[model samples]
Target: LKFVCLANDGIDEHMVWLIGLKNIFARQLPNMPKEYIVRLVMDRSHKSVMVIRRNQVVGGITYRPYVSQKFGEIAFCAITADEQVKGYGTRLMNHLKQHARDVDGLTHFLTYADNNAVGYFIKQDLVAVWRINGSVAMFRQQWMLRTFALRRNSQAESKNVS
Candidate 1:
């Protein structure tokens, strides 16, 4: 799978993929509109990325400024049914995480994912911070310091051994 960071230029394609995602969600959660899905994908305030396999979009994610006033929220993340379990989701997530730190200059990252994605986020080391009854769930900010420290320590250990 290939991942690309996109701007408004990709909104049309994104809306198509988002409609697919919305259909999947609608199976479990009723009353989700295509306009809401389109807004989630086309909204300018959010930064977005797309994952493609063989030139066909398979997954995408978006991040927007959070209500916290300090951290950015991962507004949306969706992988096509066929693309699930193939590591595309993980790749898209890592890409988003890195973008938050490097491009957005955000020290922390946040998200509100459903039960299906909660485990994936947890596996990525995102801590669950809050849950809004049956409707929404929130996760806390991801810190890059620990990752840098681990990489630095590994490099030092390698140099010492060499």
Candidate 2:
């Protein structure tokens, strides 16, 4: 599979990739709102990296970079259900890290992982960076050190939101 980085531009291929990514997220994250997914994925401030194989989009990640903060917030990451457990997720995350560092000048990544996704994030080597008073579990991976940390509130539940 090849990774296609895309933005919410007027380009035709990018528009197609965005639609495919939206479909993947809709199918993979059944609990999340489709409208919410569409809004974020199509937002100009957010960018996506789609995993394309055989000219079809199989998976992707949507992120927003905070250059001033030296980090990028991962809003949504999903591989098609059929494509799961095939190392695509790992490779996708690696690509995002490279793009964040080299292109976006980011040093860290921040993402909120729900219970169902906690394991996946951990396996990606992203641990809990910190715990807020709220119920969300924020996972962070330091690019330079390649370390992960996790602090979470198990009592609280949330949709797969950023």
Candidate 3:
């Protein structure tokens, strides 16, 4: 399971990979929404990671980085249907984490993952921090200090004392 991941900020030269991924998703995973293809290929703000194995796209991810929040949220991520459980997802995730930490100085990462992806996120140490719409699981990697939460707790304690 050797993976080659290429990072692209703007979406000019990676259209081929994007198109290939679209075809794979359409053919294999027909249930997957087509909106994700638009967001990944048409959007310029997303950071796209293309995972190539044997010169084809085995997986890909499109993530949005928020500098203010100091964490990047995974807009979308997936591996090929047949490629699942081969550790390719983990490799792609590590690539994104390295990009966030080394380039953006982000210590946290978040993603709205599906119920089936819960185990994968957990393996990456991203806790099921919350749930959205009582469906999608909001997973978070909290590697940085939570000063805001600490302060809020302290303030509440002081109020109780008074």
Candidate 4:
């Protein structure tokens, strides 16, 4: 397995890249335009990590580093069904966090790793920091502190979205 950090790629090339991602995690991606992905890929404040096996993208994670906050954030992460339950997602996260810690100076994560994904996220050392009234979940974990929280994205449900 190899990892690629996507950045500054051309739009045409990004669109083609999105096609590969779409093939494995179809409909699992965030509800956003391809242009948004291109934007993320180009943004200097963000990072997108893709896990490739045999030249195909099997999993990926997008995150942003915070200059004012103490932790970074994971905006989204997904692994193809065929490649899941094989510790690949955890491996990707470990690599992602190592990059953030080594290159970005981030030590903790501020993310919402859905209810269905709580167990997995917990295993990755993400603590349940808060939950928005039992909707979506929130997480925060530091290598030092041991507090736990469950996040909730109430607005996500109100918006009638999954």
- Candidate 1, superposed: residue stretches over 4 Å from native: 10-31, 66-70, 129-162
Q: What lDDT score belongs to each candidate, Candidate 1 first?
A: 0.54, 0.73, 0.57, 0.59
Clashes (candidate 4)? 14
Can you write out model 3's per-residue Cα lDDT over 77-114, one digit (the tens) per residue?
77888888988888887777777777777766656445
TM-scores vs. true structure, each candidate: 0.64, 0.80, 0.66, 0.65
TM-score of 3: 0.66
Top candidate when judged by lDDT against the true structure: 2
User: Where does model 3 exceed 4 Å of error?
Assistant: 1-13, 24-32, 128-162
What would the per-residue lDDT of candidate 2 be over residues 1-162, giving only the tens digit for each residue? Answer: 589787899888779889999999999877667888999999999999889998789999998888897877787889999889999998998788778778988876666554566667766656544433444422222111112222223232222222
Which one wins on TM-score?
A: 2
lDDT of 1 by residue, 1-162 (tens): 667765455567755654544454444323345556557656767656777666666767766754345467666667766658888877877787676666666655545445445556656655433332332312222211111110111221101000
Collision count of model 2: 4
**Model 4 residue 56 distance off true place after TM-score fit, in angstroms:** 1.0
Worst 10 residues of 2 by lDDT: 141-150
Which residue pairs show collisions in model 2? 127-149, 127-150, 128-149, 128-150
Q: Supply the global lDDT for candidate 2.
A: 0.73
